[model samples]
Target: MNPLYQIFVDPFVQMAGAPDLFAQTIWEGFVGGMLYALIALGYVLIFKASGVFNFAQGIMMVFAALTLVGLHEMGVHAYIALLLTLGVMYLLAVGVERAVLRPLVNQPDIILFMATFGLTYLLIGAGELVFGGNPKTMIAKELGLPSGGIDFNILGGLVSLQRIDIAAAVIASILVAGLAAFFQYTRVGRALRAVADDHQAALSVGISLNEIWVVVWFAAGVVALATGVMWGARSNVSFALQIVALKALPVLILGGFTSVPGAIVGGLVVGIGEKLGEFYWGPLLGGGIESWLAYVIALAFLLFRPHGLFGEKIIERI
Candidate 1:
């Protein structure tokens, strides 16, 4: 086959030939994309409320998962461990607000960004010390997450759907909706939006910056815990999972750093595009395309839509 024809025509022809396979691939991509969106949502929550990029969010997810698994290992019930984990995350949010954010209230954005970097390393060290540097099981069975999958026969092929993935997608969707409602209808949410727009202005209006920081950080922590649970169930709970969580960066770039809906759409696009690219174009270029394909797509989006698909444009007058 000619290179041009193979590159342009072959993949679609293969998709048409194996419709079931195509559907299966899409399903898998959707599941993966939902997880990515969950992680990206953590970033969005903090950035929107605090104007900080939150370099520690990925590690926060890993730490939250490790904390849950560690607590379960200590003979706590799975559900109990989950609640305790949320409490721990809340305490962490408070600690971060007091120790890290409060003192630096009027600092430059770069300083806040660097503070999160220190927080990341601090969490990594503390997690390793407390939980030990070992991979642990996610306790999915104890948590009541599904274990088996359903299979469908179509176009002379089989398409399998995991119950856990479906559950994860549903749970993520509900969480996102709940968060949207919270941000739109709650008093704290309005205060957060005001702070996001201008910290000094929010303070001038009698909103307590310390209280808002703690609230947003705690909100981000809740998001991290959910992402950790779902992703941990899919794979072993380990520090290495933080690397996978970093893929949210590209999702943020594609969707926009501060847009909640953008995270969902960006994640789906990255997820589906990468899976399709690897399945169809990997052999043509060589395998291992899945790893870098997302960054490439993000780079393209950066070139075309720098503010992202859902991001607001910033205009300044000199």
Candidate 2:
């Protein structure tokens, strides 16, 4: 057997020999991609409204999860803790709008982007100070999320699917649908789109920038909380989960900065591509390829479609 054949042909042969494993791998990839899409959705919400590329979205997720767990640890009920967390996120939105966006209005986009970096650090410090630097188990049982998975026998092998993963997928789908509806039909959503298109024009029509900023940030925060809960249920809640933000970057790039549908499609591509690359071709390159394979997929797509799969094409006249 030649090295090329071993690298390319062997994995397919293995998959043919065991179809169950391939199905399992694909299921895992889809779940991972769905989680990544949740994070990307948060980014889309913030970017659509304020034009700020929120660097803190991942930290916000970690912070939201830590707050929920920490509150539970301090004798609060799970449902109560959840509500309190929502209140905290709302306050956070208010504070950010008053202290950050208000003062920085009319600044360059780069400055706003930098401000989110500062916000990231602030969230990290606050989360650590309040929750300590320890991993905490998510209160999945308390939250009524499914505990274990079901196994299926196929092609003389077994494929296991976690119920939580299914729930995550369903929930993500609902969130996406709900957001699309809100953006398409609601008055506030119309106002948000208007602001996204032209800030000065929106203001001239009596739209309050501060009010819109607070609303948009709060919406992003709600998304962060939902993402944190779903992700924490799959794994332990910790500051380290912030790394998902990096994985989601390729999804954002592949989808387009301002597109919700693009995020979902991009996430699925990155997720499935990363897993398949790691499973089939990773051994040829000595493994651990999943970490960077997504970027390769994003870069490949970008070479052909620079603005992303669903990004709005721009035209300029010089």
Candidate 3:
């Protein structure tokens, strides 16, 4: 085959020839994208409410998961461990508000960003000291998350789906929907948006900045816990999962840092685009395309639409 033809034409032909594989790939991408959106949602929650990009959100997911597993290892029931984990995250939010954020109020954005970096290391060291630096299993069975795979025959081929992935999709969808409704319909949520829009304006109107900061951070922690549970069940609960969580950066860039629904759409684009690229073009590029394809797509979006698909453009007058 000619090089150009093989590069472009052959992949489409292969997709047509194997429709089942194409469908299966799409399903897998959707599941993976949902997980990425879950992680990105953590970032969005904090950025929207506090106007600070949280660098520690990824590590928070690992720490939350480790806390749950650590508690369970200490003989706590799974559900109890979950509740305790939430409590721990709540305490963490309070601690951050007191020790990190409160003192730094009115500081430059870079100062707050750097503060989260310190918080990330603090959590890592504490997690290591408390949970030990070993990978642990997520108590999925005890937590009542389903296991096993379902197979479907279509277009003369078999496509297998994992029950856990389906659950993750459903749970993530509910979370995004619930959060959207909360932000749209609730008074507190409106307050949060008010703060996100203008801190001074919100305070002038009687919105408590301190209280709102605590609420957003706690909400981000809740999101981290959910992301940790789903990702941990799919793989081992380990600090290495933080690396995967970093993919949310590209998701954020594609969706816009402040847009909630943008995270979902961006994640789906990254997820589906990468899977299709790797499956079709990997052999052409000598494989390993899955790892970098997302960044490439993000770079393209940056060049064309810097504010992202759903992000509102900011204009300033000098």
lDDT of 3 by residue, 1-318 (tens): 799999889999999999999999999888889989989999999998888889999999999999999999999999999999999999999999999999999899999999999999999999999999999999899999999999998788999999999999999999998888988999999999999999999999999999999889999999999999999999989999998888888899999999998999999998888889989988998999888889889989989998988888978799
lDDT of 1 at 184: 88
Over all chains combined, what TM-score does candidate 3 have? 0.98
lDDT of 1 at 202: 96
Candidate 3 ranges beyond 4 A from true positions: none
TM-score of each: 0.97, 0.96, 0.98
Pairs in clash, predicted candidate 3: none
lDDT of 2 by residue, 1-318 (tens): 799789778989988887988899899999999989889989988887889999889999999899999999999999999999999999999999999889999899999999999999999998888789999999988988887889988767899999999999998898889888988999998989999888999999999989999989988898899899999999989988999877999999999998999999998988888888888888888999988999989999999999899987878789
Ranking by lDDT: 3, 1, 2
The CA lDDT of each predicted structure is 0.92, 0.91, 0.92
Q: State each model's C-alpha RMSD to the native.
A: 1.1, 1.3, 1.1
Angstrom error at residue 62, model 1: 0.7
Given candidate 2, what's the lDDT at residue 197? 88
Candidate 1 residue 14 Cα shift, in angstroms, is: 0.9
Q: Give the clashing pairs for model 1.
A: none
lDDT of 1 by residue, 1-318 (tens): 799999999999999999999999999999999999999999998998888889999999999999999999999999999999999999999999999998987789999999999999999999999999999989999999988999988778999999999999999999999998988899998998998888789989999988998999999899999999899999889999898878888999999998999999999999999899999999988899888899899989989998999988878799
Task: Enumerate residue pairs that collide in model 2.
Answer: none
